[model samples]
Target: MTHAHFAPGRRTFLASMGAAAALLPFAGAGRAEGTSTTRRYVGLYFNGAWDVLLGPDPRDPAQSYDGIDLGTDALAAAYRDPIPVMMAGQEVLWGPTMASLAPHADVLTLFRGVNMNTVAHPAGRAYVNTFIPPSGVVPKGDSMGTRMAAAGAYGDLILPNVSIGMPTFNLVFPPDVTGVRLDRATEMTDLLEPLGDMPLSEATLAALRMAQDEVEGCVHEQYGRPPVEDLQIARDRMRQLLSNGYGESFDLAADADLKARYGITNPGASNDPAVIAATVWRLLETGLSRTITAQLQTGLDTHGPEWATQQPQRQQAGFDALAALLTDLRQDDPNLDDTTVVVFSEFARTPKINGRGGRDHHFAGSVLVFGGGLRRGVCGATLEQTLGLAAIDVATGQPDPAGRVLLPEDIGATLAHAAGLSHDPFRTDPLLDWIA
Candidate 1:
């Protein structure tokens, strides 16, 4: 409903723009040559910490049942239903909630050793989006979405980055390059048709433009460049919005079967996970956006006694929505061959169940990456004793006794690299195995 987060304070937004201009090379860098691919990205954020034990784990018998001790009998019962999936000739176990994604095992790769570094929700989410470890203060860096949009591939796009039902502070890029957030898919049409039935004649439109231009000239001369620049950017955005045929992407009335497949039974509530996934796929399919970030309506923060009962439902909803999205991409989306999907949570739930029968936040998390020629099979390892992430060799994406823990920065850098963006500015090393 409220889109206030999309509209940052004018002063703050302008200051970010100025700062971006000062670091032109880093912030505005183009994609590397010889890496010019039409690859697009979709970032799916599962808000609230997810429990990794609910999914696949490293095959260490000693560590295989780490979380069971803290769970109730009901929670322990859930583990007995894990589905075995064969990936790259090796069998991997997927929890019952993830059974929907089992059919696509060869295309999906799960990572087990991601360290978010913080247990706090806001900081964890920020770290995943901005790829910069938060120091209690908001990081000045832009999100991977913003950076990918700023790259040359989507430079001329009307709305290169779109955030749907997601709280984002993607401020690293220039003001014009920042992402636009929509509450729902139909909002795309609302934005494009704000005038409704109040159509103006050509003469009236021309007169209004002339008046606006004259006033803009006077403001430029009287005030300063910042205000004028901001006004111009706003005007340009409006023009681009009107010229781009983005509304077509939201025209789902004729595709009843498609809607059903995506679980969009009610068109009014687009916040449904199925609808959210459908909206993002439509945006990508229609070339309306080069990068999309969407938040699922299902919550993963099961911090109460009902966690065992609630978690499976939430995870199943997420997995089903994602599986449906992938189905459509593989069967319908024209950009399927050039797209990559990354699904992750801010953090993971603790291995030990808390007093309330629910899990608290943990420092480690897991991620699922599919499409874009990525290799199948799991990367990184979880420790057998603590159920924590083990150190990994970035180059080999394997466990090494002397390696360091894999952090959110490494995952972010890997995503940037997969999207063909330059990762020289990021301090984290990319997981080379993620790239095909």
Candidate 2:
């Protein structure tokens, strides 16, 4: 059933993130596609533990996984491009549908060999999102987006950090700054500061003007740039634009065919990859948000029979959905031609397929990057033949004699680099090369 809106002060969630509602007038995708200056950097978090492999491809040809010695590296090279880095370590997760990204690889940047101290899913996600976790009353740092907004005080068009789906503490940034969570990801804007009652008396109008002047003055003094109350208010208008079906740009129900292509039942969940992709694409088209993440969860750890039996089906569905979503994004929003869409997970499955016909979690898994001026083609080493992880040299996509284990910092640094932020705004470590 459709929920009217999240209870006040509770999580706000976006409903009908499927193709069915996208065609509706207020999905927001139809909002003017502004110039590149309007759409800046967007960060995405692939929530949940996702397995990179297990795609929709139908070919039975065997392939290398996470630098395993599958013995078919030579033949596999013919079907799958050789990734020299996988041999040295830092291979990402992959399944049959991995090739779906082949068409858009040129405009993307890839990362491998990243580490998150713990293998636990939630802990790892928090670390990836905010670079630290909460310790009881000791509050964690603010999210990257909050810092961006604070820094871009001029409203001079810096990218907005956006996270879609779920109420995540990761969205919370520093200095007691935190984002309001929406139970519905689509109606996300409602969670922000609300406008006062309309058609106010002269006294109320004077108050608004005073408030605006104060806000403008503060931003101007701090940013050393001219005031932008106009732009900020217009952008702030986004919060209310999603009421009812008025902002149906994200609704896909308008297109019966597209809706069918995505999925109707449990359409936008960790179980449904396409739904995640499509929802994210809609956000991008609005030209109102930057740094949007569409998380795909479930199926990475196979501890029981149900997971073992259902893993393949889930993988296939997710992969197919992902492919469809990417294809649609390219078709719908030409603006994303320079946008980078990444598919990531904590780690890869073990080299050896377990007795249950499932793979266990391994340190080295694969991550995919699409768009944003990529180098194109595959890098790193060829597929593996058996059950041992390989090494990688980030500098040359060759083997590192000491053996390289993917470090989480690499991915984190790469993301910061992509969005033009300092991994350690405090200048902590060397920069990562995922963007370069």
Candidate 3:
């Protein structure tokens, strides 16, 4: 009998994690259409800085470094005394808050050393999206969205990429070759006024369909068999939708009850990052959107008791919501044994509690990688209580292959890989070497 979390291995075993009530049933396209379609990768790139020590840490102090007393009660209880140095004490690394996501850890791979330098959210956001640090005006360059859009020439009929939430997705590629941008709203009136076209109303719709046929005509010539007319039809309909407008991701209001459960006072209205995350997943499952960018709330730079007591709970809520989403995804598509999900942040909190009772941002951080197909257990070093310059071999932390500290660019690279794109898509900075 499989419980809601489908437990096995080291997933969701920690005591600190919590479970979320299932929100809505999975939405499928149903048994309508055509031939077979192969599975493609779907990814989520969470933007922000999430503290490692506050969550899951997997390093054994005794063998890891000298005079290191820092360790979690979980790690301490699980690993015991004389914990082997550099040895992974657990098969999967997660906090009790993430229990709902544990069952799908097998294909997951966590990169603990996702440290970055920028504490400024905007700059860090740029660095996280594109593998380039924020510079001047354009700050960073080609993010995953642009990379996939350019590669749209390849792949199946579906747009190579699409996004929700983050503006970074909008800036990823050159506009000409970009894939369909699924705005939550579109209107036929919006199209004509912008283009100053003579064609009005129904005429405009007809013209758009004709253009789609032309695009498909060019595409069909490449194949020997009759063109996948079915795909061309889809393209035509999508073009029509674009012309008609107002087809942005599903309306949160339509599901007032579900929206309330998912905690949607409105988009970005709820301070709970979980609600935004759930909305992102809803879009992805419906195929209305391809990728989801989950960003946690700002103002977490807690420098007082308020931080310790308040911030942790917010993160817990975010994690719990994320966990529940994962549980739901699994229940719906256990076949998506390959479904991959990610949680990341700009940088880590300070290694030690500051005089202000709050933790300042730090040079090191970590990542939580789950779902899809892969290996588990800790990949990077878990501070084992000791951190900062005090970390034994900071040069090669357990999370870092050789204790190599990381930058924001590494996260973009890692996300590109996790989403099944080549890390060198844009030949930007090198990606973190976690998966391959």
lDDT of 2 by residue, 1-436 (tens): 2212111232222121111211112211222233133333333444444433343111123443443422223223332322222211333333443555544444444554444445566556555544443343332454444433222222322123445553334222221112323334544333432345454677975686567445533333544554354334433443234332334555554546656766645533333556555555555555545445545545556633444345544554555566666676667545354455566665555545556645566554455556643343233432344323346666554457565644555554444444444555323343343334
| Residue 401 lDDT (model 2) | 54
TM-score, candidate number 3: 0.60
Number of the top-ranking candidate, with TM-score as the measure = 1
RMSD of 2: 10.7
CA-lDDT, candidates in order: 0.67, 0.43, 0.45
Candidate 2 accuracy as lDDT: 0.43
Tell me each candidate's TM-score: 0.83, 0.62, 0.60
How good is model 2 by TM-score?
Answer: 0.62
Encode model 3's per-residue lDDT on 1-436: one tens digit a residue. Answer: 2112211111211100111111112112221133122222333444445555555443333354442333333232422322111213455435443444555454455666555556676766666555566674244455544443342232332333444344433232323223333222211113223233464678876786577566533323443333434445445434433544333344445666555555556644544555555565654565543444445444555655555555555556666666656655666666454455656666666655567666667656666656433344454454454554222232233543344554445555555454444555345443333433
Candidate 3 CA-lDDT value:
0.45
Q: List the lowest-lDDT window of 10 residues for candidate 3.
A: 12-21
Better of 1 and 3 by TM-score: 1
Ranked by TM-score, the better of candidates 2 and 3 is 2
Q: Least accurate stretch of 10 residues (summed lDDT) in model 2?
A: 14-23
